[model samples]
Target: MRRLAILMLLPLAACSSSAGEGTASTPAPPPTSPQAPAQPRDLTTNLAVPWAVAFLPSGDALVTERDSARVLRVTPQGQATPIGKVPGVAAAGEGGLMGIAVSPTFAQDRFIYLHFTASDDNRVVRFRYDNGIGPLQPIVTGIPKGDNHNGGRIAFGPDKYLYIATGETYKTHLAQDKKSLGGKILRVTPTGEPAPGNPFGSRVWTYGHRNVQGLAWDDQGRMYATEFGQNTYDEINRIEKGKNYGWPEVEGVGGKPEYTDPLLTWSTDEASPSGLAYAKGSLWAAALRGERLWQIPLTADGEAARPVPHFQDRYGRLRAAVQAPDGTLWITTSNKDGRGDPAQGDDRILTLPLP
Candidate 1:
């Protein structure tokens, strides 16, 4: 969900326990030094309030803009054209054109997956784009939605399954309620049915999340997610099957011993993390409230390094980030979507040099 406008106004909550424990807890480990960029480069500019971006086989970027509900085909040369429009989007507080993913087998299927909040419920749809025909078909439906805490991030995992992040929809306790779809990571087939052997035997992979917005996988095939916190800190967690990360019951780590703990936590003031991508032995998160790009170096052990902010405040609020086939980072802007001071060109897709 978008946090740029509402962030500064929300009353701050006291710092909670880091990861599941409260006070006087043992420090996990000293974070390593921040990794330096190989050589930073300013890629391109001029776009709408883009919320998400994905790369095509040809190296072109497919970007989604929130308020406008438009998708664009972006070239390395900075050229952009409207690809098509998604249907049934409800643009409000945090709802709009949210996430886009190219089919894992795009070379053959030419399918594209989208996550958006509809007038009723938030839904996932897989569609085809065959040139003349516009927005194709809806493959998944019936996800619960709320004005706040609408977790709307989707991606294809290394296992060739579609994964979805859900929020508790302002109903905090729903996070722990296994019967409901909110506040859980859902793993499903390309056709949107629960995949075989899911932890809950339902669609849920893991439960007890407040509002998860970022999903990525490391080289070792471990899944990681970024979640929005109410007041104190935002979290980065290693997602495991059947393990519950304390939500309404716990904020960061240090709530109850039974629940899984977060791998890393950052001041919400410093990070309203959204899209997450792992590449080159590191993880990158787009910071909406922090107005920066964060690069975290992961140990071979798969734990998080201290977050290092890049282009701090230079490019407005960043919403979604992804690594392209060419090894460059693709990032989108969120300024034009009723948040922050919109740059003359508040929304645009950018390419960053990765080490």
Candidate 2:
């Protein structure tokens, strides 16, 4: 068994104990840090390569299955029900139904957005969920798609504008191309129009990203994103409007004046980070290749402090990390995603208490 180590530079709070896997608490070594909470409990299991998770106003979560193109409603108590399969999803290598976001005004508009791969390209669509998914309304389209690097993650920023993250689709030059939607973070209105005050007249908010898969906002509404590097590094960037994050030109950090450097970087083996959520004064990131959950503490100035790893290799291929309405963190495993080894209840959602 791999030995677990607890290291702390700041005093972190603890969550109420709960029944779950690895429930036997590992005693802390010294008087420096508090004991880590019990291992996360399985919320739901047997999912087919679950990709993204979004919470409805009712507190139930809607989860997406990448290859199956199905949407499932998971109750707070861990019951999952397949609402419907998304139409027009072309599941291929690393591309399929990926990101889901509930409208900020979901209670009134009943709108939900999805980012998925189509037969020709990757796109974002809007649907009304009355009881089932409504007709497909394509809002954003023409994102480049390839066997890998189909950047797929979407969320509504505190500004109420929809933010879309896209990859270069392995076409390196596209990362610097302003006209192309691929390899960029786009800011658009709920109706799919270019958001007012966008640096570029088009939907492009920022450019020069390799593959961005995670987006989150801190308490002060500062934006952050996670990007995958070619082979050397993975990055957590403090997002700013119109800033260029050097991609092919600079893999990790280039002191070049024209491009913005990442706030923090990790070796690719340590963090191929995916879904990200902000809670309890920290950013929680889910790692795919590293198979861990990273909690990065933030300073008062919105800078990253130190990142602490949890559940390293405990769950296989952690994909999505989302904070539920009740403050608990919900994470999904991706063991059934073809690249991972599936366990008995492969592709499961697990819940942990936030510190």
- Best-matching candidate per lDDT: 2
The residue pairs that clash in candidate 2, if any, are none
**True lDDT of residue 298, candidate 1:** 81
Model 1, 54-160: lDDT tens per residue?
Answer: 78888887787776777888787778888777778897767777888888888898888888889988888877766422564766676778766678888899999
TM-scores, in order shown? 0.89, 0.90
**1-355 in candidate 2: lDDT tens per residue?**
1112223223322210110000112323322332353579999999998999999999999999999999999999999999899999999878999999999999899999999999999999999998788998999989899878898999999999999999988798999999999899999999899999999899999999988989999999999998877656678888999999998798666878899888777666676888999988788899888789988777677866556789999888988989999999999999888778899998899999865
Best by TM-score: 2
Candidate 2 global TM-score: 0.90
lDDT of 2: 0.85
